[model samples]
Target: MTELLKLSGVHTHIGRYHILQGIDLVVPQGQTTMLLGRNGAGKTTTLRTIMGLWQASKGEISLAGMRIESRATPDIARLGVGYVPESMAVFSDLTVKENLVLAARDGPLDDAQLDWIFGFFPALRRFWLSRAGSLSGGQKQMLSIARAIIEPRKLLLIDEPTKGLAPAIVMALIECLKEIKRKGATILLVEQNFFAARELGDNVLVMDNGTIVHRGEMAALAADVPLQERLLGLSLEAHQ
Candidate 1:
């Protein structure tokens, strides 16, 4: 597969704190690469940096071989990159339809796009006219992801889509993300849910402190309990 996003020797600093240290990563086209790590590993920061939400203090970040390290956040987003933050970032005060309408860049909402989103998240369709603040956590997550894919995008940066969600909801999300991957979406995700990561990830990177320490096939990492214990310091078999 051709590389869609690449970060080479990337570093980020917030005030006096150096968070990312010589980080390097590659996101291939048409694949989901899971970024797994414990808290404070800079997973979220890496995603933010890719979206230009946080500037890289050093090194290179390129999307489809074009340099984007210095571009503004909105400009980077316009270059076919979509981001679904951990916070979900849905318009709580707006109706679901209105929220999606805003996500479509306030243009005419396409019926096909609405249909596509409904396929992944039936709840969104059911509550199209309901206020986004009234939806449950899982529904909000679905809406966040739906908005990110309202239009065709070359890459999607997703962070912790299943956090604090129930088991059934997590399973539903996993299935939905699998479908998204099948439709040729290139995704780089930060997830702590082992099951979701193991299921949706084609490739995996394990981070510790501030840099990635393990890079390999997701299946390989999933099958190796000792390695998981070493890197993640836990059995990658919980929450099943």
Candidate 2:
């Protein structure tokens, strides 16, 4: 598979605390690479580091073979790297339409694009005129993802896209992600939801205590219940 992003010996420091110790990984083009680990294992930090939201204190990060660790956040974004933060990061005061309008960079919102997004997330269309703050958690998550894909993107760094949503919403997200994947978008996802990961990920990278502890095909990890317990202390059956 072709590589879209790579991190070599990447390290990050948050104040006095050392985070993301020596992260080395490759995100393949047109596939989803799931980043999974227990809480506080530096999953979020890794995404932040890749986005240039937090500069790597050491090592190199490249997107499509060009160095980008020192690039500004917006610069990295404009280079086709879209980020859907765990926090969702929607403008609470803005209407759904307004939020999407801001995410489109080149010109007026394309009707076809809006129709495509609405197909993936009909709630976004229903709440088009509503303030984002008034939407439910699931709706807001949908909106966050829709904003990231408002324009064409090459690589997407998504953090916990299924967090705190109902089973129905999770299923919808799963379908939406599958559609995104079918369109050949490269995705680096951080998810605790193993069920979702198993369905969407082609490759998997497992982290522990600020370092990658495992790397393999998602099917290999998902099928090995013993390995899941050892790596994540999680029961694959429970997640199912």
Candidate 3:
């Protein structure tokens, strides 16, 4: 598979503290790569760094063989990189329609695209005119994902999408992501839910102390309970 995104010896700093330390990573075209780590392990920092919200102090970041480490956030987004942060960053004062409208960066929302998105998240359609802050947590999460994919993007960086969602919503999200992958959008997902990770991830990278501690196929990690324990400090089944 062709490499769509790559990071070589990347390092990031916030204030005087080092967040990422000489990290090397890769995401292949049309594949989902799971980033797993405990809290405060720099998983969010990695995604933010890739999105140019936090500049890398050292090393390199490339997308489609184009150097982007020094690019601004808007420039990176213009290169077809969509990001859905863990915070579910929705416009609290805006209606659902307004939110989606803003996310359609290229032009007006396409009818077919809206229909496809509604198929996965019917709530967004139902609450189209409702204020984003008035929606439930699950609904807001759905909207967050909807915004990232409102337009066709080459790659998506999603952080803990299933963090607080219910089981049915999580399953819906998994199916939606599978369809996105089927349509050739590469994804780098940070997820704590082992079930979703096992279902969606082609490969897995475990991070610890701001560095990759393990990298391999998702199936290999799922099948080996002891290895899962060693790397994640818990059984995959426990998270499921």
* Candidate with best lDDT: 3
Off by over 4 Å in 2: none
Tens-digit lDDT string for candidate 1 (157-231): 999999998887788888878877788889999988888888899999988888989999999999999888888
lDDT of 1 at 116: 72
Could you give the C-alpha RMSD of every candidate to the true structure, in order shown?
A: 1.4, 1.0, 0.7
**Residue lDDT tens for model 3, 104-131:** 9899999999999999999999999999
Model 3 steric clash total: 0
Least accurate 10 contiguous residues by lDDT in model 2: 231-240
With candidate 2 superimposed using the best TM-score fit, by how many Å does residue 199's alpha carbon deviate from the native? Answer: 0.5
Each model's lDDT comes to 0.90, 0.92, 0.95
* Clash count per candidate: 0, 0, 0
lDDT of 2 by residue, 1-240 (tens): 889999999999999999889999999999999999888999999999999999999999999999999999999999999999999989999999999999988778999988988887899999999999999998999999999988888999999989899888899888988888788789999988878999999999999999999999999998999999999888655654
Off by over 4 Å in 1: none
